[model samples]
Each structure stands twice: as structure tokens, then as C-alpha cells.
Target: MTTRKIVVSALVSALAGGTQLAQATDVFRLEGFGAISRGMGGTAVAHDVGPAGMMTNPATLSLMPDGDQAMIGLDLVTTDIKVTNKATGESVSSDTHSNNRGPYVAPEAAFTKRIGAWSLGVGAFAQGGLGTEYGNGSFLSRATGGLATGLDNSSRLLVLNIPFAASFQVNDKLTVGGSVDAMWQGLNLDLLLGADQVVSLIGANRATGSLVGVLAGIPGLSGAHFSLTKDKFLASGVDAWGYGGKLGMLYKATQDTTLGASYTLKSQMNDMEGGATLTAVTAGGQIPLTGKIKIQDFQMPSHLDLGISHRLTPQWTVAADVSRVFWKDVMKDIKVAFVADAGGDLNILLPQDYKDQTILSLGAAYALNDSLTLRGGLRFASQALRSSTLFAVIPATPRKHLSAGFTYAFSKQAKLDFAYSHAFKETMDNTSLPNTSAPIEVTHAQNNATLNFRYSF
Candidate 1:
């Protein structure tokens, strides 16, 4: 297909998958096609030749002193999430629905070259994003008890970052570079809840309790008929914008060994304002509650990345990386300011906090010949969040990743790349709910695949 067609088709698929905005949590994965490629053993040259290298290490762009290069790539992901209610011994399941719409297509483009004494370049790419959905039907029957209660949640985060970098050759065997980044980001979220079963339970309790009261001292209570109507509560689309910066460095100890590190500061977003609609039966009539809520500015956590790569032979190279995400910074309560139509204001819900996380990854690559290369790697990430902080509105599983990829060089200027990753199955059990005798448990699994076409001039 033409490049335009591919971009359009990929966008349509991405939007359909974007519908799961409510199920996304604060935690996200950093692995992408570029990093996956680098993880396999591609050395960062003083010249730009691969799309993966630009994102994995922007300083590598300055290494490309020969020609200016640009690239576009796509990624596809699949995930499986299961939650078991430990109280009742029942399970709930969800998947990367609709042809694995769970994946994202990340497009990258960069321009770089070397001057008499400096190498400079600029590029744009996605920094972080997430999507997930859970159907009520996934809940076990014993837990649901034939009640039509379910949840639908969706969310998306998009970031556009441009980095200007320059590299200087300090010595015969060493090079150093630094970058200043300007970033813009967007966020969207939606949540829905169906509580027919909870309403029925409330109604039944009212009737039985009223009868007992009438037999004692309240004669009129026994004659009252208890009734309840199901209600649907929904929080619609909310959006926000933010800014941040990144700094990085690269060191070449020898011709075959390289070390790199980078730090990306957190972006502080503008407060979000959106309307919410709550439908319910109140005092013998259907009442619709409509109001606007102000979500305070929330800051995304900062990231620390360290990596090392070494060439073992003329055709073989290996690399490893460690990343730390300060999720604890996100673990504060989210406060929503409510504004009444009458012009009064109130605090809706208390703020919510999240737990911290860490990720470790290692990869290797081998060149079969001048034209064929193979890569593989492993990544392990910490759990999504503490059970005490998890909510039905957002469900996620901690993940362990295994991946393999290959590149076929059509020529020195072009190559075709393919990668596949499978997330090992893992489960989580929740037994802590206020005033509940039974605890809820959730389990999850995830996977992804990607194809990239790269060219350098």
C-alpha cells in the first residue's frame, strides 16, 4: 500500500482502539519498535541509519554523519485481563478486543547531519500512551447473581515531543552529545457504570427490614412496597495539555562498546473541566444529575534510563537497559471540583494515589550475513498498582515480556523490520473492600507485534 494509505488505515484502527480510555491506568510500557530493535544489538553509529536508534538514543542521530534520514513505523498489541472475586471464587476476563485494537502505531521521523565540529538533529515521536476495556459479561455468574451490572471504561494519552540535539567528538575514541526537548501532550478519559443488581439488593433489604419494623412498633411500614430502578452513571470525555523536557548523553569507550543514559522530567498538565451525567430514580421520579467537574492539574512521573551495548564479534552485539518510573508521585488522591448550575461549588470525590514501578530489559542481536539480522529480548515490569488503590474504572495487569525480531537489508539505504512480543500470563487478587466480607481478585496477560520500513539517504 501507498504510505498515505498505510498512515490513514493505521489511524482509523488506532481510534477504534482508543475507545478504551476508561480502562487505562497511570502505569504504561516503554518498549516500542525502535527500542526493541536497539535491544537486539544495533550499534549507535555516528550516522543515522535506523529509526529505532533515534528514539532509543537520540545522540546516535549525530553519529549519522553521512546522510539525512526519515522513517515511519507501526505497532500492534494484544492483551488479556482476568479478575477473580476471591470472596465468591468467580472470575472475570477481557481481551484486546476487535482484531487486537489494543496496539498503537508510533510514527517517527528525524533529520540529522554533521557540521565542521558538531552534529545536530531534531525528531518527533510518542512518549507514552495506553488503552483498555472490560465488559460486564466477563464477570462470573455467581458474582453477578443475574444482575445486569457491568462497567465500560476507556482512555488515551498522546504526546508530541521534539528534541534538538548536538554531539561533539571529544577525543579519538570518545564522543558526547546532549539534547533539549519541547513536548506537548493530550489526554482523554471516559467511564460508565451499571448498578441494576445493587439496586435490587437495596430494594430487597428495604422490604424485609420494613416488615420486621412494622411487627414491632411501626404498623405503616409493613404496607409500604419497596421498589428500585436501575441507574447509569457516566463520566464523558475529558482532555488536558502539558509540557516537559529531556536530557541525554552517550559515551564510546572503544570501537565496540557504548554506554548511554537519559532523564525525562515529568510534565505538569492543565486542570481538566468536563460535564458528568448521572441518571437514577429519586423520590418516585427519574432524576438526571448534570454537573461539571474540575480535575486538578496532575503531573506525570519522571523517568530515568541507563543502558550499555557491546559488540562481541564482527556480527554479534548485545545490550541491556534499566528504567525507573516514579509512580508514587501519581499516587495522590484525585480531587474533582463540582460546579452546580446555580453557581455553587463543591468537592465531589477524594483524590486517588498510585504505586511506583520499575522495568528491566535485556536483548541480543546476530547478523547472519551482510543482509540479514536477528534480535531477541526479555523485559519484566513491576505490578500495576497496589490492590488497595485499584478501582473498577481502571484495570491493568503487571507484565513480563519476551520478544523476537528480524531485519532484512534490501540495500545499504533501506531495510524491512518485523518484531513480535508475548507478555507472560499473570494474575492479581484483591480482597480489600470497605465493609465487604468478600475480596475481589483480577488477573491479566498481554502481547504485541510490529512491522517497520526504514530508509536512509
Candidate 2:
């Protein structure tokens, strides 16, 4: 293979290995794209952040200097997550339990070349994910009175994107660009559901057919609990591949001001299939069955962003963005089916009832000197999922964020960029599922850092 091909292959492998686990800020999506963008509050639609823009606004690639540029970056994420199941019952009431999964790490790489009016690039990025883990001894498992022992409560969702993008400078003031992304995603789950909750979901969605009848007729099943577990980590779990794309435009409205916009299409993915164990806790005993599991219709949501950036002075620049994500259309329900080896089949539905989300970002960057730059930003977002339906496995409840970072140039061709961000703690009472007298309280908070090494010729 040629040198360029080899580099691309290595970068792809690195990205695949790096997206094993991630805790995001904007529900399942990350708060930022690159170090520079993260420092200034996850703003990328109007500002230029090199090849990383392919994952944000591909048209921004046109703003780079006319040369070859490459970047390798890593994101270090730390999460503070705790789940509390407060019940008034006698056998299942318990205290708070913590998720000991992270700090996590995700790697990314991109190469872009600008020639005349056309800019082209290829890049790999860990778009985002959600994860949480609790031991079997916790209240979630003990709620089953040892009927669900060894069945820990956990879940993980990982997504990665590889985009081949191209941008054209339509005129002196307008640039248009787009990218075709190859998407890959994986899921790991170890969830235990009460019999009452399962029955409730089936009624809520009006699920029908012979399979549903068979499940309802099973003896001693009404008072039982169900556990769906795939014995794997987030890295090597049941996975699927899909395709999606984004369209973007940049308009140089004036000498120092620019307007930008982008829209991402929802992913088209196949069902994720893999081996799993299904355990049923009943009055008679615990029934563990070996089976193959299928996660059906799990797809990411689509979103649109509008933004503007302007240079206040020779050394200061400011940007703002408004975004809307169509979550309700995609996250309403997720179905899982299990076909046992010995006999029997079962199906269940996970209801999200998520609403569309709106986000606002504001950031500023200052060139302190020729060799150094400073950045800061703030982000506010509306709720995506209803708190009453929240669970430990998916606590997507971050509403506000603060971020800061800097870029230090060592020479003309090399620079190091770093950024830090914090998602404040959010706690909510979930009284919807896992049917108990009292509500389940979920608290989540996070901190993140991005470091990148950039080189250009």
C-alpha cells in the first residue's frame, strides 16, 4: 500500500479501538468536536476548526490555508454518575449505587487538503455514547430477592463516524460542502425488568401477535422478573453498520463576519445481533436460557444547526449557534427480541418518550500573542428524555456546561491544542418504570478534556 493509504488504515484502526466507551454531554452526542471548539463551548458551525469540521460543518474546511493538514487527537472523559432506587416496600427498598465505568478515552484523526476552490478530507471520529454499570449486590438486583443475582444492571451505546467530505468555493463569498459518512455502532446491556413494568410497556405500545400471547400465558411469569444480558463490554458487543451524510454551507457576509448552517441525516442501520442470556425470575425458580438477541430499530437522531461568527477585533473572535435535534421521532421506542436455543421466544420494548432538544452555544477566542490563543464558552440545552422514564443505564440529563481551552504554537507547522469542559450535576426523580411505590432518583455530572497535535505543510 502507499504511504497515504497506510496512514488512513492506521487511523481507522485507532478510531475503532478508541470509541469503546463514552459518556456524553448533549444526551448521546458529545459537547464538542475538537479541542479548539470545545474550549469555546462546542461551537463549530461558523468557526474553522480544521478537518474536524467534517463532523460538524464540512464547508468550514474551505477556510483553512491552501495546503495539506493533519491532526491526531484524544478525548479524556470523566463521569460522576449515581443511581438511587428509593422504594417503600419491604423486600426491595435500598440506597444509592454508583457506576464505576469511567474515565474513558476516545481517539480521532483527520487529513485535509485545500487546492484552489476545492477542499477535500477524510476523518474518523467517536461521535458519542452513554454508559453505566452497577454490581449485582445492588438494590436493582436485590429487588428480585436473589432471583436476579449475578445479573448486574448496566448498558452502553457507542457510535463512530468515518466521513469522506468535499467542499467547493462557489464564489468569493459562498462555499458549499457535504460528506458521506460510514457509521458504526455497538450496544451492551445487562438490564433487569420487573414483570409489572414489562406488562405495562406491552400495553402502552399495544404490541400484539402470537409471541406476545405466548409470553402472557407463561405460568408463574406474571410475578417474575426478566433479565436481558449480553456478556461483553462496550468494545466487543453486538454491533451494526449504517450510512448517513451531512450538508453544510458557509457565507462570508462581510469582511469579518460569517454565517453557517448544517443538517445531519438520520442513520440507516440494520438490527444488531449477538449472543445473550435471558433469565426469568419466577415463584418456582430462576430460569436461565441461552439465546441469540436482536436489538431492533436502533438509530441515531438527525439535527440542524445555524450559526454566525464575527471578529470583534484583530485579536478577538466570537461565535454563537442554535441547534435542534429531532429525538422524539427516533427515540420513542427500542425493541429487543430473544430466541432461545432450547425453546421459547420473548420480546420486550424500551420506551424513551424523548422530546426534541434545543441547544444554544456561545464562545469567544482571543489571540493573546502570535504563539498563543485563549478560548472560553458556554452551552445551554433543553431536556431530551422525560425524567420519569430515566434509568441508570441511560442518564442523559445535562442541561448546562462551561468550557475553556488554549492553543500553543511551537512553530509554523506544529501546534498543540487543549480544552476542558464541565457538565454540572443534575438530579431527577423517575417514577415511571421498574414499578415501585417510590421514585428512582438519578444524578449525573461529568468532566472532559481534549488534546490535539496538529501539523501542516
Candidate 3:
């Protein structure tokens, strides 16, 4: 069979499915790819940038400098978040808490080999993942030893994407390409509840409400519900896998102008299967129980990108792109089934109701000379998640980004690329249930930096 046939079959079987890491907490969509792309405010669609461009638009491969090129890079992200707690009638702040999950690193690598008009490449990288760690026994779990005695209140999600890509020049003016990715994700979450929180959840959480309502009529049995929920040890961890494909086209509209478009299919993943350990504090110390938790109806969002780049002169060029993410289809809600060791089975549905989002990126680059080039860009993304549904585990809502960077050559075949971006602080209020509990006010801000090295032969 031909390469096209094999690729089609593999993508159908692999890319159709995808994972369960928590929602990304950074500035949406993995914060613009990397240094080369990030330096231009994530504008890889029309202006090619070696291996970094492979994940954004595979067709750009045909337009790359003719040679075997390899690249390795990392994006270091620092996120600052604060949550306003309202467990009581009054409000108190949780004192600014930075993510306890340290070394927040995103790494990537890619290699390309060109033969005539054909460009073949392979890449491995983290597509996107948002993770955070607040001490497990703190905040909401104050009754159970609060901040000092227990595990941290935290959650994590990681999505790994590997694409095998190929691009071909259709003629002197156009190029097309596609790639299939084997995507997998991992998730871990830990949350504790106090008496007030338990009361609030019993009323707002459909699963807990239904389970507790059964004992309402029985005078002696009703109190048992509160005991089970009070200082409740609630946490779970799981892993999932799936597949997806990306298609792209690049056209040379004029001698100095290039146009590009690309689409990424949503990945369908298997149900998240894992175990949760439940424990409660008693006079005899801590009583523990373990059971299974299955999460279903979860998938990653799909997005479309279009771009245009124009070279104003031999040393200067400008580019712009628009991308839209269909988050509603995949992030509407999460359904989970709890198989317990003793206290009856319960099924819970967590509401997300995420909306679609559009992002605009504009950038320009000027070559200072043969060994150095400078670039800067701006990007804005409309909020996709409603403030009411925004949870602490997923605090990635930011509106504007300012970026600047440069590329310097140390030798003929070796070079370094670096970018820096700062997302203005944004505060999303009432990021919790509207009337049931005190509105959870969440504030987020970030400092993002990336560094990369390229070697061509």
C-alpha cells in the first residue's frame, strides 16, 4: 500500500481517541507553542519556523530552508493565583498561593529530512496540560488537620502528542501536508471538604444530594449523611489515551506574500479509569477505604487556524493569524461513576459548559544583520469558560499577552531562539456555583519564557 493509505488507516484507529488531565491553567492553548512561534505571538501558520512550525502547520515544511534540520526547546511557565474563600457568611482570602507543583516545564523536539520537494518530519511534545498543587489538607479541608498535617490540595493533567508528518509541494505556488498523532493524558486530583462545604455540596451536587436524600425520612439515619460528608477525603487519579489528525495547506499568493490554513480534529479518548481513596477522621485516628472511579464523556477541543504573511523587504516581514477553538463539544461536562467499598454506589456529573473561543495574533520580524533577528507580537483570546463554571483546578483565563524576543546565530549551522511573554493579571469572579456557595473569586497572572536551539546540516 501507499504512504497515504497507511497514514489514513493509522489515524482512523489511533487519532480518533484521546486523555483526562485537568484543564490547562496557563494562558490557554499551551501558551503559543514555543520560542520561535511565541516570539511572533504564536504566528507559525504563515511564517515558517523550522521544527516549531511542524506542530502548527505541517505544510510549512515544504517552505523551510533546504537541509536536515533538528531542534530542541523548553517553555518555562510561572503562574500566580489567588482564591477568595466564602465557606462562612463572611469572606476571607487564601493568602496568595503560587503553584506548589514546581519545575513547571514544557519540552519539545523535532527533526526534518528533505528530498526534492518532499519534506518528511517527526516530532514529540506536550500538546497542552494545566496542573496545580495546593496543600491537600488545607483550604477546604481545614477540619482534617488543615495546612500542616495532610497532603496538598492539588490536581494535574498532562497531554502528550507525537506526530509523524509529511509535506509535498504541489507546484511552485502551493504545498499540502497532514499528520496523525498518538495522544495520551494523565490526571490526578485531591480535594477535602468541611462541614459547611459538605452542606453546600449536599444541596448543589446532584450525586451527593440524591444519595443523602434517601436517609432523610429516617430520623436516626439522616445524621449519618453529614458524618460521611464531613471532613470527607475526596480524591482520585486516572490516565487515558486517544488519537487525532491535522491537515494544512500553504499557498504562495505572491512573490512576497504567503497564506496558510489548518485544522485539527478533536481527539476521542477512552473513559478515565482509576481509584480514589476515601478516609475520615475518627477518635481512633483515620479510617480509610478505597474504590474505583470512572470518568466518561471527555474529549479535547478542536481548533482551526488561518494566516497571512507578507515580506515588506528583504530584511523585514509581518504576519497575522486567527484561530478558533470549539471547546463546547469536548468540555461541556464530566460524568463520573463511583464504585464504593461500602457506602452504596453514587454517580456524579460535574458541569463545565465551556464555550468556544477565538484568538488573534499579530507579529513582525526585522533582521538586524546576517547573525541576528528581532521579533515582537501581540495576542488576545476571548474567554471560553463562563466565570461561574471556572474551577480552581483550571485557572487558565487570561485576555491579553505582550511578547518580545530574538534569534542569534553563534555559527553558520547553529543558532539560539528565545522569547518572553507576560499575561496581564485577570480576575474572574464567582467562579463557583452562583447561589449555593459563596462565589469563588479567582485571580490569575503569569510570566512565560522560552529557549530553543537549532542545528541544520
What's model 2's TM-score? 0.91
The 10-residue segment with the lowest total lDDT in model 3: 221-230
Residue 88, model 3: lDDT of 44
Give candidate 3 regions above 4 Å deviation. Answer: 1-28, 86-100, 136-138, 143-151, 193-205, 208-236, 279-287, 341-344, 431-436
CA lDDT of each prediction against the hidden true structure: 0.52, 0.78, 0.67
Per-residue alpha-carbon lDDT of candidate 3 for residues 1-457, written as tens digits (9 for 90 to 100): 9643443344344323222222243333675665877888778888787776778888998888898877767677776766666544333232223332434566667778899989998876667776555543444334322322253345566677778888999999999988888776666665443333334445666455233443333322211111111121112267677888889999999999999999988987888777775544332344455667677756777889999999999999999999898988888776766666666565655667888888898899999999999999998888887877666656768767888999999877778999988788888866344211345667777777888777777
Candidate 2 ranges with C-alpha deviation above 4 Å: 1-18, 88-100, 144-148, 205-234, 434-438
TM-score of candidate 3 on Cα atoms, chains taken together: 0.82
TM-score, every prediction: 0.73, 0.91, 0.82
Q: Determine which window of 10 residues in candidate 1 has minimal summed lDDT.
A: 221-230
Task: Name the candidate that leads on TM-score.
Answer: 2
lDDT, candidate 1, 244-327, per-residue tens: 655666687788878777666776667765565333322233334456656666566777777777889988878777777787
Q: Which is better, 1 or 3, measured by lDDT? A: 3
On a 0 to 100 scale, what is the lDDT of residue 444 in model 2? 84
Instruction: Please give the lDDT score for candidate 1.
Output: 0.52
How do the residues 349-373 of candidate 2 rate in per-residue lDDT, one tens digit apiece? 6677899999999999999998999
The clash numbers for all candidates, in the given order, read 27, 0, 17
